[model samples]
Target chain A: MSDVSAHPSLSGYEVPIDSWTQPFWDATATRKLVLPRCADCDRFRWPPGPFCPGCHSQRVEWVPAGDGQIYSFTIITKGDGDQHQVFVPALIEFPEAGGLRLVAAIVETPLAAVRIGARVELSWSHAANATVPVFKIVTL
Target chain B: MKHESAIAGVGATPYYFRGQSAPQTLYEMICKAILAAVEDAGLTIRDVDGLAFYSMGFDSGLIAESLGIPELTFASTVSGTGGGSAGVLDLAAMAVETGRAKTVICVGACQQLQIRYGTAFSHMPVTPEKAWERAAGLTGPGQVFALIARRHMHTYGTRREAFAEVVISSRLYAATRESAIRRRPLSIDEYMAAPMLADPLCRLDFTLETDGAVAFVVTSGERARDLKRRPVYIAASAHGGTCEWGRAFHWLNMPDPIFTTAGSEPIAARLYAAAGIGPKEIDVALIYDHFSPLVIMQLEDYGFCHRGEGGAFVESGAIRINGSIPVNPHGGHLSEAYIIGMTHIREAVEQLRGEAVNQIEGAQFALVTGGPAPIPMSGAILRN
Candidate 1:
């Protein structure tokens, strides 16, 4: 069963855990980022399909992601009545991983401070029955 | 074959917002629409021998059983998923032309508000997307289109205000008609001030959580001559999708989709050729407006304007009611109820029959398109 915990600002937080996804979640619990890399094309396939989207290779493995960059983002303002909270939800891109983009929330960062081409590193946030991937803008 | 079948009648339930409307189940809304279509066609339930639909709204067999459509010889559930609204009419027409069924009615029904519509696309449990896609807060339709809109902006330098024309035009049209749920005249300031559901997309860009159902009846041109209303001839109908459009909605890594080509683009040439008319000859158009950028995409895809110039074409007032060509005089999904794309077909039928509330001047050809990219799309050309 999943339980609820509050973040600084974000709504609709539910994480999924299953066989193909358990390792990713387990790694997240330990604070690591991993993705499916194709054996034939040596490119990472996102959303973890059985066959590699690149070269139709079923031989794929979950490997660590070096890093990602913010592709595009949206500022979500959700709540009831007068009480509202704002957070940035973004699609982060891994260049060397064959265009595998991760849809994660940007936490512990001000919405105005986030940039379109901002570089971000992955961090984990525990919620309910799973660990969710959260991102923070990388400072040089 | 071009004029083998025609639309005999169209019907719809009074559209309402989630809580503002009467309490009726999704099935009841569909039944109301289907029965209304049968009555509008001036035919009894016994004459209805065919049924077609998409998105698995409610079982066709059970729907027929409920409607007393006895001995259904033709029943087709289209394969494009929800993007097959235009194709449903084609399938119904196919049934009539092939003599599989004498009278066929295509129906589409959905009550997103009741179904917790938010969870359907976003939460892809029992799949790999559960871990990567939905869990990351990218579940809403607004998110997918936000990505597409941003790409369009990046590629063509399309301004965010370029969508103002579409929003304003649709609301203005809606205000003139009583059936429109979103009748308040929308101003540019209001549109700009609307809260963001997804980046590049404000609340105005998204369609309302509509509760209703729509259906249209199709039969042979010869048989349609004896129906209740003027026969809306189906000059050409076609539908298909891109090469790699999967049933599951994950297209982040795919090469260049949505912005350039559309689900409706693949079948545009064939439909226009079959209709024996060009886009310039079309009196009105009812392109899908589930999102603002898609309306722009369809305008480009259907040859109304050059590629990547959709933003400018709409902003220049070319699509206003009295402009060179009017679009979605019924307000479309943007201001109108989001009955999937079924309402677009219903509006096209009414416009061609010269019965629209915001009727065009003696429209001859009407172009109606169905769902947007990442899914197989469909479209049809109708003549009065």
Candidate 2:
């Protein structure tokens, strides 16, 4: 486990929090990241869907997400220039969660230190009207 | 071993940057392109009895009403975002194959500057691309593909030079095409100097947004043979995604994912199988190069080479003129106008007709593909 960081420098974009996505976003407010798992298949789902994409079962449960690794990443250099934002966004994959990947902002990791398969843990930061999940490198 | 229908003629508005001197509105662009293809085929606009487009909201009835098309026996709009460019060709061919229509126009149009897809795409609300993803900084498709590129590099030791080769080859090809958007020769130094838009993807890695429309006329092979221009045979067409392979919609995340599919592999197999020819026969390729790395992936997925050999395969200069297969001789979307990948189809038709600006000697077959991933993609084979 690692300590959560503050909202990123350009992290104040208002995200549309709807009924379908409310549960996932709400978890971030408490500095937690929850993954919606197919209640029937036990497979973790992403982006919030009503049914299990695997079995088409109309059942899901948002459980506290498990640890994941840095599957891959990229440092987006071209921001619209308004956000004062330059950072590395990473795709974190859960080996336990059937290879499901969650895209999260990697904080406190230097660009040179970002490894393709490094372990990571979830952290959250409050940004305009929403709390978004960020990830911290799990250093031994 | 053949397509039941053939592309008799192809036409397009000149490629231009999205907002730079777009001479016509979207409707005007479509009408102009339709008329061009119609005239090229030695037929009147009135001859078109069916229409298909890759998801622009076109009122076929209104466009036809103006063109004096009495009735359209078939009109369809294929979906899949940018991946539908070649899919619409399949739909038009199907319409002509059936008794639904004798002549059909498959059109792809985009006014991205006026209708900034590059901007709106960052805010996409599709399934698995919810607000959380955007809020989490997974906004642009480049970033999504960037993740894929990184994984690919780690998986295969792919180098940035492989990407530069695709861009340079396409740009050099575009330099000869009068309508190509980015005619300026892109050098290795310039490509490397270009700022990274997304990590692993430089600004050049992304496709140019252009305001343009491309249209092609398709009809039965027997009818095509009678047309003025040499009919480019539609040897095969296929479209689908990797959902069955555990890929979530609009997201690259998948179980045991290779990140090489926008449903390209299976579709490529189906294409070669249906056409009764293997990859070696393809003389040129107008692969969808919305981003450069995917072009490498497409090469491999299409069985142009074995899995993981895309990096080296392209490095062999095989994708250049007279090498193995000239790719995007009119520059791809990267250098050419990104008319939503229709230019790729237009280029294929021109090549098969032996009219390509950088025509391959005795070229017979051409391959055209769509966006690399995140949805059901489309592709087709054309033969002279």
Q: How well is each residue in B276-304 modelled by candidate 1, as lDDT tens digits? A: 88999999999888778778878888999
TM-score of each: 0.89, 0.92
lDDT of 2: 0.77
Clashing pairs in 2: none
DockQ values per model: 0.38, 0.51
Worst 10 residues of 1 chain B by lDDT: B245-254
Q: In model 1, which residue pairs have backbone atoms overlapping below 3 Å?
A: A3-A128
Q: Candidate 2: where is the Cα deviation over 4 Å?
A: A1-12, A17-20, A78-84, B1-3, B123-129, B244-249, B260-262
In model 2 chain A, where is the ten-residue run with the lowest total lDDT? Answer: A1-10
lDDT of 2 by residue, A1-140 (tens): 12222234445566776666788777778787777888888877766776777798868788866879888878765445554456677778877766777877888765556788888877675667777778878876
Question: Of the native A-B interface contacts, what share survives in model 1?
Answer: 0.47
